[model samples]
Target: MELEDMPLEKKRDGDGEGTSKLVVEAKAEGKQTEGNARLYLTGCLFFTLISLVLMLAVIVLSVKSQTGSKDCPGTGDDGRCWNIFPKIQAQKLDCHQCGDGWLLFENTCFYLSTVRLNWSMSQKNCTAGKGDLAVISSQSVQTFLTGKAKSFFWIGLKHDANQWRWVDNSALGVRYWEDNLSNGDCGLLRGDGPPLKNWMRASCNSKAYFICEKQHTSLLTILWTTFFMYIKFCRIYGGDKKDDAKENLSSQLSVELEGERGKQTEGNARLYRAGCLFLTLICLVLVLAVIFLSVKLQTGSKDCPGSGEAGAGRTSTSLTATCNFDQCQTDFPDIQHQKLHCNQCGDGWLPFEKSCYFLSTMRSTWLMSMIECTTRGGRLAVISSQSVQTFLSGKRIGLFWIGLERPGSQWRWVDNRALGDSYWDDNLSEGDCGLLRGDGPPQKNWMRAPCAHSAYFICEKQA
Candidate 1:
């Protein structure tokens, strides 16, 4: 019977015999299903761990981007990190820096300092930083500051102006102080201790560093303060004068900005014009090139000088060179690199010991003939002209050679044109060559002997 059709107990226990196998078979199947469920739970936990790690990586990247500092502070209103740096606002201007080194009370300012430097150098450094030394105006304010100012300090008081003066060069007034001195060229504090509030003068050279202050009064604040002072129930006296002053200051600021912008605009215009001209010139050149190419195509090659004829002209010209460089090489091969003033050669040949040669041996290839010189240290016998050659040829009782050659071969020489037409004496009539002989009836092959041959071996050397 089919497994599905059979009764459950019969299939599991197989016929009956009191075996009880059906219940054991069912328990085994239940255990297999439980194992599968446990595997699925383990796989889900691993995937969950991977998702958590990826989420953490994204958060760390976001925090780093936000906290990084790139641009410098104090650059226009974009400095949104105002709270992180010291900021002071007065009127329409905003100034942010470290902090004010000087303190102000009532109408006057004061400072207490520690380190000290020389007078001139200290003034320079402070000016560079846009501040100056302390100037004590009133006796009470001075006394309070100096009492707290323990160490020696410099002040803006000086007698170098031909008389005593404060930082701004105004004469010291006795109205604000209990006492005053004409030549008080130095600065110090009064002896009032608990808040010893007074100013005194000591030596300026004594080492000290003092405080300085710069103040800017807001237009709004000034207006309110003035209004409160002159209040006749808001009658407001002198408001017109204050407004006129404010307007003047604003106008001056605008003028300065306009001047700066005018210069910048003019510079930009010049740069733009230069760029436009450069591009226009480039376009013009390209158009001209196209026109030139069209003209060449329409004309014959010989007329345009650009078709295949250009190459033929080069080869033809090279072959047609009758004499190199416009001169008859047979007569003046060594004439180049010469003084243009040299209209002609010097008088008769520049005769050495026994032969005639050109006065221009200085231009000859001395290196080419070094191996072919004679025992007496003579070289390829140079002849200034046919007359000199004839004399050398006829006078040689023994055969001597001159620099003459056949159509091809070593530059073997013969005793002038008068030597026997048979140039059989030369080693090979085919390579760069030369010859040497002594004064005598024509002899042959003697030219190939080492020019180093002893002087006694030849007629010229026999002497």
Candidate 2:
């Protein structure tokens, strides 16, 4: 009802109630607005924190990339810089490239001298080239030197205090001594003989050619260079952004880059898996081929027997088979049958008196040679008789290891027999084992030598 048409007391009561309801509704609307404002502020703060975290992650990644690059040096025409993200042109290096006139082998460079010089002077020449006299350490290296050395050449070996040593002050572990020499402080390699019989001792003042050795550029250097280049490329392409608009743009770019990288990583993974599978297949095929070849070889050997006289000798009824095809056997009925006896020596063994001897073609250490002989059900040859010694000395042209050894302070045979009727060389001063000197006199052909020296060995067994 209108205020003008209402009674005074009733009108006052209705107006107070309406006014109170309006005040309560106004308070509720103000609280709702405040809550909405607070929620909006909280959402803004959360987004800002997330953006900051993403920026921090990017910075950390950049720092790691930069730190990793420090270990790798610069290479190529652009110094240390690279454009990896854009795939721009950059220089590459071949780290294994050797210097001019230097031959590469494994990870080392070797230079052979054509002119002659004394041992000291040759070492000086090698030092001038930032290298040392070639130190022979392996069979492959020894073979290489043997091929290059046209005549007696000087090596890094020197006799110090009656012991042979290398230029690096390392004691010789694997020796290839040709003979036990009393004099000569320097080492020489004979270019004419086999590799096992090449090393010999000579005077230090003797003039001869030499070899120099040095390390070549390594693969690790190339890997480091590549890593540095990649880091430089990342720094150049992933520059920093300040404003939000630029930051958003960079975020989009980074997302795209990540997508590309993911795709590339997947592709590389697939390629690696495929390569592994292909190699596995190749290995399996090779294994199958080897098995098939081995089976075929065994079958062929079993099927094809010895031919002609050998076959006839192997058969038990040779006369009956020969008589079955020929009437001439009836005409020569006076022929007598005889049984032949074979030698008692085993296969690949030489019969000498009541013993079987085996000469090794390969060179090995004294202990290793002993193992080989034991594996063959024998032991190293014991020179107990002068006739046996004379026979062995006549057969070998180079030093051959015997069964004699010096276990404690005295010389004894492998059979634990004491030294009797010794044939030791007069000039022998130091050594732990005895060797037959094939180039020396028959009466004094035995000489003392280090047990570690590589030489052809002799094994003996009962006949």
Every model's TM-score:
0.24, 0.29
Q: Write the per-residue lDDT of candidate 1 for residues 389-438, one digit (tens) a residue.
A: 34444443443334443324433332323333432353533323333343
Task: Name model 2 segments beyond 4 Å from true.
Answer: 1-96, 180-182, 218-463
* Per-residue lDDT of model 2, residues 281-305, tens digit only: 4345444544554454334222111
lDDT score for residue 9 of model 1: 65
Tally clashes: model 2: 0
Off by over 4 Å in 1: 1-100, 107-109, 175-184, 190-203, 216-463
Error of 2 at 335 (Å): 84
Best prediction by TM-score: 2
* TM-score of model number 1: 0.24
- lDDT of candidate model 2 versus the reference: 0.60
